[model samples]
Each structure stands twice: as structure tokens, then as C-alpha cells.
Target: MNELVLPNDTNALNNLMGGRLLHWMDIAASISAQKHCNRIAATASVDNVSFKQPIKLGDVVTIKAKVSRTFHSSLEVRLVVWTENISTGAKAKSNEAFYTFVSLDENGKVMRIPELIPETEEEMQLFDGALRRRQLRLILAGKMKPDDATELKALFFPEI
Candidate 1:
């Protein structure tokens, strides 16, 4: 997903606000998750978000997201943000984040989702990284008293 950085997305100094950028990232992540789940996937949580560069008005903000991992009915999406200067056409990395989504059926209940098929090495790497992040999130949430990464890993991954 992409958006042209406009005045409304900026602050008093005309720089893009982190909140607005994060909102867009969530939208992008949801889009990617929904594409895979084919249902309503709501944001269950967001992991760390790091901004590496600042984007200004007139920059073409590009957000890329893909399903990195999944658990019973939850999906973790990895999002990368980039910006291209409208005039100079130079692109720079902006930020990155991980979003967790819970796929819901028409009754608004969590439903089973198809297994993620990692087609390439990049995807496999992303899936592995997302698994680590998911574990960290679970640990932070106090869901893992034993602090076992494998226990947390089992939550979002299927035995192949």
C-alpha cells in the first residue's frame, strides 16, 4: 500500500507524525493479512515499531506487508515502510513493524486459517523472524510463565 505524504499527514513543522505513519502501517498489514485469511482479521497487537528515517510532504510513502507467521487463528504480518521523494525520486527506508491479527468468521469468532506456505528464502526468513518476535510478545504479555520459546512457537505454527 502507498500514500502520498500530504499536508494533513504532517505536523506543525511539516514532518510526518509517527502516529499517522503507524496508522497507515496497520492498514497495510491488515490488507496483507486479509488477503491470506479471506476474513475479517482484527489487530490483536503490535510489536515494536522503529522509524529509521523521516518522510516529508510530497514523498510517496510505500508500505509493504506480508504474512510472516500464523498460529491457530492468529497471523503475524511484517510491514516495511519506504518513501520516495517526488522530485528527486530517491527512495529511503522509513520504518518497520510487526502486527498480529486474529481472523474472525462472520460470527466474529476466531476461525481456523490455512497454513502459511513460505515460497522463498526471504519468506522463510521473515517467518522465522516473526516467530521470534511473537515469542517475545507472548513473554512480555505473561502468557509464557516458563519463558519457553518453543511453547510460544507452537501457538502460531503448525507441525509439518
Candidate 2:
């Protein structure tokens, strides 16, 4: 997805507001999730989004999203946001995040999504990290016991 940052999309400092950028990211991620699942998907959560650089007005914002992994009815969509200065022809990485989405049937019930086989090395890396990220998210949401997150145990207990 590509968006032209206009004056209305920026804050007083002429930088694109975080909320607006988030909204665009959600749309791009939703498209990716829906395309993979072949069903409507609702955003379940947004992982931490750190703004590496500010996107100024008149910049062309490009959001690249892909299905990094799928579990049950939920899928993790990896998103990368970059900004290009039209006048200077310079591009910079602005933000990166993982958005979770649950595919739903026409009746709005969660439906199983298809599996994703990552072919490239970069895709494989993203696919491998999704489990740890999901475990962390579940632990933070209080939906899973910390002890059950085997993938996240290494962070606190390195010897494991």
C-alpha cells in the first residue's frame, strides 16, 4: 500500500501522526491476512510499533505486508513502513510491526486459516519468530501461563 502524506495527515511538526500511520498499517495488514485466509479477518492485536524515523509531509509512504505465520484461526502479518522524500529521492525505514488477525466466517465465527510455507530465508526467519512473538503476546494478555510459553523461556532463562 502506498500513501501520500499530505498536510492533513501530519502533525504540527509536519510529521505524520502515529495514529494515522497505524490506521494505514492496519488496512495493509488486513488485506494481507484476508488474502491469505480467503476470508474476512479482524485485527486481533498490533505488536509494538517503534517509529525509527518520522515521515514528513509530501513523502510517499509505502507499507509492505505479508503473512508471516498462521496458527488456528489467527495469522501474523509482518508489516514494514518506509518513506520516500519526493524531492530528494531518498527513502528511509520508518516503522515495523506485526499485526495479528483472526479470520472469520460469514457468521462472524473464527475460522481456520491456511498454512504458510515460507520459501525465502527472510520469510523463514519471520516465520520462525512468529511463535515467540505470539507466545509473548499471549502471556502479556494473561491468556497463557508464562511457564507454558516454551518459546519465550529463553529470554528470561537462558540456560534452558
Candidate 3:
């Protein structure tokens, strides 16, 4: 998804507003998740979103989103945002985040989602790391015990 950083989308300092940027990211993430599952997907959670650069007004914001991994009913969409200055043609990475979406049926119940097959090296790395990320998310949300986060525990305790 690409968006122009118009005046309305910017703050008093002429930089893109964080809320507006988050709205755009959620849209991009939902589209990716819905397309992956072929169902109506809703945002379940948003992981750490760090803004690395300030996107100035008149810049073109480009958001790339893809399903990093899928669980039984939810999937993680990794999004990277970049901003390009229209005049100077300079581009910078603005932010990166992971969004979790849950597929839903017509009755609004959670439905199963399709699996993601990572073929490329980058995709494989993201796919492999998604499990640990998900486990941490679940643990933080109180849906899973910290000790039950096997992948994350293994990562923190390499000798285990």
C-alpha cells in the first residue's frame, strides 16, 4: 500500500502523525491477512511498532505487508514502511511492525486460516522466527504461560 503524506496526514511539525500511520499500517496488514485466508480477518493485536524515521509531508509512504506465519486461527503479518521524498528521491525506512489477525466466519467466530509456505531465505527466516514472536505475544496477553513458550525459552536459554 502506498500513501501520499498530505497535509491532512501530517502533524503540526509537518511529519506524518503516528495515529494516521498506524491506521494505514492496519489497513495494509488486514488486506494481507484477509487475502491469505480468503475470509474476513480482524486485527487481534499489534506488536512493537517503532518509528525509525520521520516521514515528512509530500513524501510517498510505501507499506509492504506479507504473512510471516499462520496458526490455527490467526496469522502474523509483517509490515515494513518506507518513505520517499518526491523531489529529492531520497528514501528511508520509517517503521516496522507485526500485526496479528484472526480469520472470522460469518457468525463472527474465529475460523481456521491457511498455512504459509516460506520458500525464499528471507521468508524462511521470518517464518522460523514467527513462532517465537507468537509465543511471546501469547505470553504477554496471558493466553499462555511464560514457561510454556518453548520457542522463546529455547531462544533465551540456549543451553536448555
Instruction: Residues 5-79, candidate 3: write the lDDT tens digits.
Output: 999998899999999999999999999999999989999999999989899999999999999999999999999
User: Candidate 3 at 56: error in angstroms?
Assistant: 0.5
Tell me the TM-score of model 2.
0.97
Instruction: Work out the TM-score per prediction.
Output: 0.90, 0.97, 0.98
lDDT of all predictions: 0.87, 0.96, 0.95
Task: Give the per-residue lDDT digits (tens) of candidate 1, residues 1-160.
Answer: 8899899999888889889998999999999999999889999999888878788988999999989888889999988899999789899998888899999999999998778988899998887777677778888898865447874556667581
lDDT of 2 by residue, 57-132 (tens): 9999999999999999899999999999999999999999999999999999999899999999999999999999
Q: Which residue pairs in model 1 clash with each other?
A: 70-156, 71-156
Which model, 2 or 3, shows the larger TM-score? 3
TM-score of 3: 0.98
Q: Tell me the spans in candidate 1 whose CA falls farther than 4 Å from its real position.
A: 151-160
> Which parts of model 3 are misplaced by more than 4 Å?
none
